[model samples]
Target: MPKVTFVQMDGAEHAVKVAAGTTVLEAAKANDLPMVGTCGGSMVCATCHVKICAADRARLPPPTEDEEDTLDLAFGVTADSRLGCQIELTDALEGIRIQLTSTM
Candidate 1:
């Protein structure tokens, strides 16, 4: 299992443990976190936008070109921005932390 921490824009945080191979959006949804996956984990929507926190940003795999394109439509795009639906959980991401922007 891997633990993911989601920090809301208001500074509230929710941590959830999920199985490997889960998407960040799925984990968030399963735990009732505020992330909104409007496209249901498809790469087509930017509603699942989240910022990879500085501490865990480097641990994630680089985003694909499509993901980058979708992110461009997301509000509050930042250097660390990522669409949660596109991020799959892995053993290496055990303690990943993400910050929810005000976009949603």
Candidate 2:
């Protein structure tokens, strides 16, 4: 299992352990974290945007063009910005940490 940590706008954090194929958004939703998935993981909405912690950012897979396009509409976009719904959990991301922006 991989553990994904989500730090909300208020600094509160939630950690959820999930299977390798789970998406970050799915992990967040399963744990009742504050992430919003307006498109239900369709990659059409930026509501599930999150900033990947620098330490674990490199472990993630490169984002697809569609994900990159959606991230452009996200608030507080950073070099590590990613659409949670498009990020699948993997063994290398066992302790992945991400920061949730105020917009989502």
Specify the highest-lDDT model's number: 1
lDDT at residue 49 of model 2 (Cα atoms): 91
TM-score of each: 0.92, 0.90
- lDDT per residue, candidate 2, 1-104, as tens digits? 98778888888878778999998888888888888888999988799998986778777778888899888888888898999898899878887888887663
Instruction: List, residue by residue over 1-104, the lDDT tens digit for candidate 1.
Output: 98878898899988888999999888888888787788897878799998996668788888999999999989989898999998899989987888877655
Q: Please give the distance, in angstroms, between residue 40's alpha carbon in candidate 2 and its true position after superposition.
A: 0.7
Candidate 1 at residue 103, lDDT?
51
lDDT of each: 0.86, 0.84
Query: In TM-score terms, which candidate is top?
Result: 1
Where is model 2 more than 4 Å wrong at Cα? none
Task: Give each model's clash number.
Answer: 0, 0
Tell me the spans in candidate 1 whose CA falls farther than 4 Å from its real position: none
